[model samples]
Target chain A: MEPAGGSCLLGKWGHPVLQAANDTFRLNADFFDYTIIALYFAVVLGIGVLAKRQVSSSIDFFMSGRSLPAWVTGLAFISANLGAVEIMGMSANGAEFGVATFHYFWIGAVPAMLFLGIVMMPFYYGSGVRSVPEFMRRRFGTGAHLVNALSFSVAQLLIAGINLYLLATIVNRLLGWPLWVSLIVAAVVVLSYITLGGLSAAIYNEVLQFFVIVAALTPLTIVALHKVGGWEGIKDKVQPGPEQLSSWPGTDLTGISDPLWSTIGIVFGLGFVLSFGYWTTNFVEVQRAMASESLSSARRAPIIGAFPKMFIPFIVIIPGMAAAIIIPEITNLKSGEGDTGGATYNDAILLLMRDLLPNGMLGVAIAGLLASFMAGMAANISAFNTVFSYDLWQQYVKKDKPDAYYTFVGRIATVAATVIAIGTAWFASNYDNLMNYLQTLFGFFNAPLFATFILGMFWKRMTATAGWTGLVSGTAAAVAVAFLSEDAFGSASTGLIGLSGQGASFAAAGAAFVVDIAVSVVVTLFTRPRDEKDLKGLVYSLTPKESLVDPDAKALPWYQSPTTLAGIGLVIVIVLNLLFR
Target chain B: MSTDHDGTTDTTPKKRAGLFDIRFVIAGLIGVYGVILVLLGIFNASDEELARGDGLNINLWAGLGMLVGAAVFAVWARLRPVVVPVED
Candidate 1:
């Protein structure tokens, strides 16, 4: 019933109540561990300094001058998501749901990413917009653009706080610092590099942090898997249910409790609505692809990112699944036995690291945790400042400003956003499972945006009035659903409906998608459409064949073609799903 | 996907990563950690430490693996550096 035959483990899941102990970081991170971590911080700051020299103009700062290679941006694309959201959130899902958590990547992420690469990237890249809001401005005009810019900036700040809180959690665990002090320090570090070098620094650090995360988790997974006695060990122990062992009909993860509805929820709500909405429209991801050197590279970035994205659940989810049996507190939590001190599903990865890893390896894991958090937070801040300066401030507050003036504003925006993120971190800390909070945010922001975008892109008859009104109504509907549903908004909810946990978010997303499309369509029939000339590159039917894809693609090899590469990715993901299923 | 060129052109080359390659940065940092871990495995990896990992010298093995990965990245950067074209 304890952490199987070992005793050296000391660090526990950090709780504010435990702060009075004054020595909460009981795990042994000695001389070698400190050196390795110190080396990591040095490299991170050094990369920021080097990238600072590359910034000469606003474009260089905001969009990396659209000059990064496909490989760099590809890794950065996945890495940006690799933050606390992907690491802690998904792992928490894995611990709670077992192998069923594979649905997030295979079902929720991969197909959507391939869809982005094959379909959406060309419109984004070929149109030559700096950010997604600019594309909205061109396609639907000022109303939708203003709505998108404000909502997106607000969304980024809130999400950035999640990453910031988790990053500060590591500092709190590592040096036993108080959470508030750690939050400020972590926010400042993410802000400094981003403010100094802009997107290039963010991208470069992201690439390295990607590897840091991979390296950190690889060892932790191996050790954890070995400790739990591998696949058979997991099957014998951690026997939550048959549903937990398979990838189908994940009633536990979705919290729907019915087999058919859970399957439908995973496939439609998460796979179709939430995932497509997130991967295609959310600028946190789109900006990475948009930074690629050429349109060809831009189209390939997400596909290339998908290859690695296919297998990350192995390192992330396995350790979490093993945590249920490996950590005594988590094992206690896994059964109907409730509240084992302060351990929640979110502590699954941290608990595994504490029990399984020794000093040197422990340092690597800690560094990786920090890297992932910073990567996620940096991604949000970088995206926030860009949208704030370009979309909001430039258009409404100070039009006709010089490029240099905007760049200065962007740096200022970074400072302001990071500070605001520190404040928002309090809200994120309330959720035991971060995924519940994150998926709700996505349902609110991305689902409506995707509905508006897909409608406008395909049906050119969709008027400008339909665009903004649809967004507002869609978001309002999702809000209403969350408030109406059982415990979607945590303490703020009315708990009137049957849904809670991630299932509530799924219901809200589906409602948003359906409601937005219906509203946009009804409004479109009542209003005037824009001129056909303005809709060329923005609308799919009106765009020329040449602009949608590289005209010279036929001359290139199979590997160079986006279609060929995406096809390969799809095959691999399908195979992975079936094998796990 | 191509062989490494001189990273120069008649129209003035501006490398994608102007100062240093991302590969080198990753390789160097991971490789440095590998060396430190390798030393720790040799000198400080006690029997008690080994017991915690189920008799595996995780530091030594993981360190060696990282070193190999570092070498692969170094060679990759050497063979095919990023070829980005910047406008004047």
Candidate 2:
């Protein structure tokens, strides 16, 4: 398990050494950098003010009044998921695990995004549901709805808090700012736009933030490539083996180090279970697609997003791979238990920024980092507010409130959620291995969700009772596997199923999927099926063809169809996998 | 299918002034960052900065590119202001 450079023999306790190494990595922001960041904040605040006037009703606040074009929603859809953790964590993994990290994007994200657009959007958009849980209510009844809503609300709060904590920590560590100062500054900026402008403001800023991130980070990547002498140099320098440079799993050289998956695990565990569960069911991402102007536009949103999602690993992951070669001392440092005076792997992106980027461009890069963190927090907070206002509050606590009253409540919910998230962030700070725990938590939530959605949407024979049972048991199965696997196998073991963290998650999800399907099919066979008439629009077999098709799309060329576009994206992904392999 | 929750089809178009549109925010950001980069590249950058960028003024070029992008967004918004249709 030691790094290729070999272990540092500094002592059993590694914190002091790591702390000293961290101290060596400092970024001094000049006035120009501050000005650029300040201007970014001001522009974001101005957008919030303008968006505020647009929010006159709950629909406007929660769903952008369902009026955005495909392109806008598409960019925002992908951007909503691009948090600070994703940028930093992916690079960290790239540095630690190498090209195997590409599995997260290609196998984990692409296929699922396409499936959401091509198959799932018709049910979600055409059903006239305000939230994902509302669709659950329509298809699976009140019990299933409550389960989904409660889990989603809690997950969003925790995720938002984690993002907030991580971003502030990065700022404190890299720039020597106080943690509280960073937290307060972030809270104020995020609260202003989201409270005033609502979902529209959040989505618009996500798109803006997406561009800012690309503009800022793209140059850093190019510079890093140059510093390493180019792609050829990266190949020669990044060590251990050629597997570090390749994307395919289970090759002779890769089998020993890369735990991404076996081919079976990648197909079933990642491509089917975890990916489908996340991209299809996670409301934080699906909310953007739901906001599109028409059913057709909603379907097109994820397809448009898929193209960009495919390339993101290059921008985010490659830098880490390069860092592994260029800064092995820092990249190789292991945290916790063993004592080494080296930076943790999570510090990869910040290290790259500090070491490579100059002053003015450095400011832009930092602003991009800030924008990404805020975008992530905003996406989660916005989703939380909407689910709370509609699913929990309006459904149970207060009924038939005026649209204006619900809008007011949504804003109040946003504030409440942000406070709760800050508390969660503080709680999470106690954990030494936050990322590992977060992955387990996501597995607990998402694995069973895709199973429920798949059966409920496709199989009319699936009873509401079965739907509820499948979700509960499936989630329980995922949780049980995560806990039991850690106990049965040593903590350092690859996974219960002998895979890396992501691969283990996929293994857990695959187990959950099997459990969910078995439970759902057995329960449905014994119980009475829902009347077909009641399942209209929610179930695939019962929905009218008109509801699924966009008439306008018929006039476009065959190449412009969402299915066609997704196929093109898939082809590109395959080519990339082969090229890298 | 196109009806709002109030059970009526929404047909009225909501017109936003160009200044009030989100594109304006996007343009403002690009312009601000672009100008800063250009200024830094032209007047203040040291020889080390120039060398670090591999003898190309990345700040200058990237800044100019951003400015062009901002202008395109501005002109596009002016030519066709964002109008949300209340009805399908």
Candidate 3:
């Protein structure tokens, strides 16, 4: 028998059982696998080449000529948001935390996506704004626009680099490829497509990637479920603590490790604040919706995405939960141990693929992994270029540049963003729990954003000064809460200021959101409101009836209406929540 | 909004052929991968390989599914090629 705690020791590999497990878990791809992966790359590059012909102007480059249909944009909408973190980290969380991780999908993503489609898209699409920050410029004036644009651009660059870093690390671990090799390859591929076809290239690749990832993962999930004896078998073998199994997080808050897993935190912080902020304000995701052929198409994009978003948890979360039972040692896989021994929780999906999948299927799964990482990085790169060129360079640095000039600058921005992303990735290497840090960073950026957007869209009385002040103050509040909580509770505390990671982020965002609203309301009362005529189509109350209604929507069958589709989506979400609960 | 050098508005819609569309890329990938898997499933099976797949050639089935998906995208693209809209 192996040692009690350190069973993953080098000597343990010699043991018969350990040898079998380790052999299967190592990189086992053959010539066939490499051929499949090479074919995928060739196809991606060819697509990039073909897409370049469509790019004649800055608008086409940045917004896909705003001509995408509902199905295309809708699929791309969800795919753009499906980062390496969503596939790997969510699975890691599933293995570690169990059913509670589903909250990130259902409570955290679905409702917000629906809200974006049904409520917010009218203002965004009808106004003919090129980007999310442009919406800010029209609604609140230049100051708010600058703040949002700068923050988003910087964040996108950092995120793109992180995506590169993650892809490299996963490739290094899975294929035994060197880190530099994976990074350069990913950078080259992403830059090629993004710079060539622009947003259209990115969106098309994203839609393609969505199917590839699903096809890749579906087999693994099916095989793993069969290996583990099915759903009941997974539950029986997992032997999780009560909190791990319970979806109603409030009931077993004390038993759960993270304070953020608390029902209140999940609902308020992830569900409301972060979800709304991200789905509504983040242009990386919303850019897909905005690219639709019509206002109604834009409205239907996120609604369509919501249906698939509901089912994603099954593909992503189940593998992790199954791994928890089948390869329990994965959860204990720590950092710093050599490649073979220290397989961390993040290796949950990888471990399952290695153990369960045969040769040809394994190659496809790895390709899917590559596709997901590229899709995520491409999304951020495209968003970064758009925001930098239009919002920053055009607005501030070089006003009245020709359409071609802006398009040229956008391509140049893609290269610059990739460089900065690499730098951020190198800097991020110093952090231990990169995903946790990312979540906190997201909270800081997004929480205050939702507050600003909600008030700006709904309340015409809100002043431009208030808009800028609320955003700045809300971000500051979130940052202050994160730092102060760590200091007060001691760095080692799991729940700082009486909250878990998600909870802490929620608290910070919640505090920031409240502070932004309070400050905005107080300041708006004292300040002058924008002219009602000036607010036409920009504010909810001032938008015209024609702009508000989707002419095609009324003509469509009842099931095809955005409202009915959203209702169906909500029903699925509620059912999933109940089933898991 | 900018006038052309000849002083006329540029009204030509920017649209590409369905073959050059990005969906074609999806089709090409799915088709290529599907064909490869189907070939492998039929001819290249050792006893160990069969055991590894638990006697079920998942490659053949998945490959067929992927081929169908590719055909759907191809048809969709052929039916409605992307057309770059006139700027509002």
Identify the runs in model 2 with alpha carbons over 4 angstroms from their true place. A1-24, A250-261, A331-341, A433-439, A487-500, A557-560, B1-17, B51-56, B75-80, B84-88
* Cα-based lDDT for every prediction: 0.80, 0.75, 0.75
Docking band of candidate 1 = acceptable
Worst 10 residues of 3 chain B by lDDT: B1-10
| Model 3: per-residue Cα lDDT over A542-570, one tens digit each | 88778886776577677567888999999
Best by DockQ: 1
Better of 1 and 2 by lDDT: 1
Estimate, for each residue in A1-581, the C-alpha lDDT of model 1 and write its tens digit: 00000000000101111111123235568887888888988888887888887788999999998888788899999888887756776677688789988888898889989989998899999999999999999999999999889878887887687678768877887767788998987887788889888999999999999998888999888888888898888888866656678888787777788899998988888888878877888788889999987788898899999999888999998998999888877888878586566677777887787777878988998899899889989998999999999999998899997899999999999999988888877665655345344435444766688789888888989999999999988888988888887776666678888887667777887898999999999999999999999999999999998998876667667987899999999999999999888
| TM-score of each model, in listed order | 0.92, 0.90, 0.88
Error of 2 at A461 (Å): 1.4
Which parts of model 1 have CA positions greater than 4 angstroms off?
Answer: A1-25, A426-442, A491-496, B1-19, B83-88
Candidate with the greatest lDDT versus the true structure = 1
For candidate 2 chain A, the 10 contiguous residues with the lowest summed lDDT are A1-10
lDDT of 2 at A32: 86
Better of 1 and 3 by DockQ: 1
Error of 1 at A144 (Å): 0.9
